[model samples]
Target: MLIERPEANAGTTGREREMKDIIIVGGGYVGLSVAVAVKKAAPHLEIELMEAAPEHVWQKDERASAIIAAAINMLKTLELWDDIKDDAQPINDMIVTDSKTGEPVKPVFLTFADRAATNEPFAYMIPNVSMVRALRQKADELGITIRHGAAVTAFENNGGHAKITLAGGEEIATRLVVACDGVRSRLRYMAGIKTVKFDYGQSGIVTTVAHERPHNGRAEEHFLPAGPFAILPLKGNRSSLVWTERTDDAKRLVESDDMVFEVELERRFGHHLGKLELAGGRRAFPLGLTLSRAFIAPRLALAGDAAHGIHPISGQGLNLGFKDVAALAETIVEADRMGLDIGAMDTLERYQSWRRFDTVRMGMTTDVLNRLFSNDIGPLRVARDFGLGVVDRMPGLKRYFIEEAAGRTMHDKPKLLAGEPL
Candidate 1:
């Protein structure tokens, strides 16, 4: 069915309808993050976050998310950082290496521990459950409507507002609708938007490991011919791993028994972590990048994974989403103060302009990184390895890459990320 994407009707009442100020569809990291950020900024705004699931997927989403410093500050401004801060594993330094041919590629020390001397840690490792739990608690305390099991069955948007029909047959109207749903956001499809997608033919097998040796807060990134293997430090004696592999190999690994699986896992993850014992159930997610054709259409906007998905090579996926949270929240709050509909095209474009480049650029950069590291070409291997060595020797250039990974300098500067918004 061809859904109509209409412009605002002249003289449409912004708040005269029955809708909440914003209706966010998805309760994943993206959705919940936006809900918390926006509601924290404009408390008087009625924000309803509707998830189709029966309850928060705290258990299913055992995946670990890297809470970069910029993202941490956004949560801090929303008063959400302290709630889950203890559950997070701080990243003091990181190591990147090439393990395929016994020759080391670029290895540089990351100094995010003091926020590149800016007085904050670079990033923290947080589990999906911890963040969801924290947000749920904060949302309850803030009085934002956290509606689970309520999926939007249909919707009619006319720029000024969106009339949404729920699965339970209830209807509501909202001035703005932000889709923070996953890569396959139903709302984006319903809005009749197109996306550019390219699967990397790789699958990420993620799980946590309990080891005999302490990580000492050193995260490792190893580039192999197949894909990137990341060992992100977790709470004492444990580390979270995202190992990318060929799709078929990924399937076999996920389906394999623990004993068989541990062997393959240890090959990519060195013995430095000691005998790795699985601390969490193993799962797989396909790797790809998807960029929406457009991020804003008057009353509707897209944020987080709904707008773009990136490769996990540099572990910037969640950080990018948090960047979205910061941009959209700031735009909406500024617009609201001026008595302008926060959903207006002009207001929403601020967010679109703020986020689209970072998402697309990061997506492209990660994709390039993936392709460069996951191939077995001799000349390419030599070139990339030398490049890494060159960067490692240059302190100034190393610091630049480290800062970029920390999400300190994004194309869109939210005041909170710039350490000014709060």
Candidate 2:
């Protein structure tokens, strides 16, 4: 029912006469990873990526993400870890505290020191630019065609393949389509896949700060009345902060003068780290949870934030996307090896079922954590603090949490996540 334009075959051979094997939409870490992973494993597959932004846009991202141990294994398997390791700062220790914003002395409800037990840091904070750079380099090495400034204007599933129309009116025919676009994905909407979404009425203010004293790779999460204030260590004396506050308050603060902003920041970010200075620009992102009802539709599959967008309370948002990359990549590669239709309903279902439970579970977990902590109700505060203290005292329970956070306790993990290649 769909026709491929003559211009679409300009550079094609007999193998690419009608359609590309896979077309991944989005150019973020997750989208690029999917392209690299599948192309690396199955060199015969004709793959291309369509990015809506310009070629150099990703380099402008000033944000950083917390990468867990399991995701590190996948990056190593992709041979990207070496390029990123130098810029990555390990999370050697983490402590949790519950107190008011101006509390002089806050009691530590829980502390986790897991590097000794795991023989590796639980996670690392890696800049977005570094991760994207490595992935783009690898994608080029794999001969994956990445088209920038090409946004999807239309998408159609033609039973056997998919036809995607670009904003420039160019048409692409592909055996499969993978959408790794962000939470508000146009591809997901085009697929008619509904989502269960909830706005938290809060925004996370993200910025980098340079302090006089070193953090020693320690991270802290201070649960205050508004929401969680997280201090995640970066390289040197720099730390990235995810400060949650009411929506209106966050907007005013981000727009406020530097002096007023820093004053309020100092009130929450104690003096333990000595004087703090703004290391980079600040931005506020609205907090929300969005989970697609289905991960697959016809010959299309969704990955990354396109599939699930969870709150940052547990710092697992990007890590969750990495997990999707690992699972979905393995599924596609294995199906190709078996000479099965990689975009067939059965094939995509395997990936959907494999990822659905984990996605929903994480979404619910973050939701509960946000609701339970982002309040000043005295009774609730006392109960949650007691719970944290109890968990901290139980060594075995604490170990389980560390293992889970490091992604070591997951069952039936993909080969890439476990550091194995297809």
Candidate 3:
């Protein structure tokens, strides 16, 4: 039997402690969101988030996240949606165009984002910095320890709890551990979990551009033979662009001079919103799909990009992380109510079961879309565009697609994802 330590009286009346320390690995979107969700479910739980970097590296890029509807509701539950909502640009509509030489072959108007609000937006274009700031601030208020410049160099899971050794030589003992450390998670490897992943022969180039005319809160996507060129609306007359191109060409673009890059960008970005002048810095990321073969190992579990990585054709990276947070939080909370060990493989498997399929499905969906739309085949283009047109005209089908993009699909949503933590 394990021995319990007695609580010390700290100059106050008798009140038992409520929190049990839980160590979280990494401080990215996934790591921080998991901490927030866990604390929201059980306010008394002690949570510590570790980040190896001194400052959040996410600030290096000027890209923004297309906040899905479900993720917005999650921010609401954490009392943070109101804070960053104003900085966001709601995607009221989306336009798809073809880069083919002939006249318009494929043109479909998308109204999925309006589902996020009954009549408002299906999703909002919130900058990476804003979301990171908001999550960091919320962590402070929720009493979640934010440990910057900290790394878990080594760890041990004794089938019951995880003991982590930090780079600074400090040690932490926690009953539960969540690995939100991105696709290159050492914790997952150390836990002896294998991963399945494949790299797409493409690279995503992210940057911000200022247009001559207002986007009017509208987004645009250009389907080129090379890959998808997505322009999500941003505040003012600026928009964030995610251009997926051949890996070799992407390398050249990243290294191209400002003038050379601008000319190439103009070709990819038509003059719908008028002249597009490059703004912010440009960065490229090789595309891939990575999923942990097994999500739960003993007292440890994985979430966010650490659990899975997918193509960004649909802007679902952070949203997927939030989904992981919601499901895991619910499972742990429900287990708490049942008076069971929240970190046990049996209990953690509930979260794994609840989320793995969706991750796989989404990863596959993005992969399929990238391949189907990235090719120059005329027949396939005609077919895919025809499919888009058909869906756009079908209200029921359109509504269903809209709701799914909004993250309101009822089929596999967990309790916390539905805006009520169990």
Alpha-carbon RMSD of each model: 4.6, 3.2, 4.5
**Sliding window of 10 residues with minimal summed lDDT for model 2:** 1-10
Backbone atom clashes (below 3 Å) for every candidate: 3, 0, 3
lDDT of 2: 0.91
Name the top lDDT candidate.
2
Q: In candidate 3, what are the lDDT values of residues 1-422, reduced to their tens digit? A: 23232233222123212224578899887788888877877886678888988875766747799987777877877777878988999888777776552233445534443444366476899987888888888888888888788888876775545677777666666678888888999999888999988988899999999999998888777778888888888999999999998899999999999999998887777676788788899999998888889888887889888898898888888888888888888887777667777777788888888888888899889889988988889888778888877777787887777778888884678765566645
* Worst window of 10 by summed lDDT in candidate 3: 9-18
Better of 1 and 3 by TM-score: 1
TM-score of each: 0.91, 0.96, 0.91
Q: Which digits, one per residue and each the tens of the lDDT, describe model 2 over residues 286-367?
A: 9999999999999899999999998899999999899999999999988887777788889899999999999999999999
- Top TM-score model: 2
Error of 1 at 319 (Å): 0.8
Cα lDDT tens digits, model 1, 1-422, are 11222333333344333547789988877788777776776788889888888873566777778888878877777677788888899888877777672342334322332245475557889988888888888888888787888887776786556777778677777788888878898888888889999998999999999999898888888888889888898878888999999899999999999999988887777677668899999988999989998998757889888888889998888888878877888888788777777877878888888888778888889989999999888999779888877777778777777677777767647887765653
lDDT against the true structure, per candidate, is 0.79, 0.91, 0.79
Candidate 2 lDDT at 208 equals 94
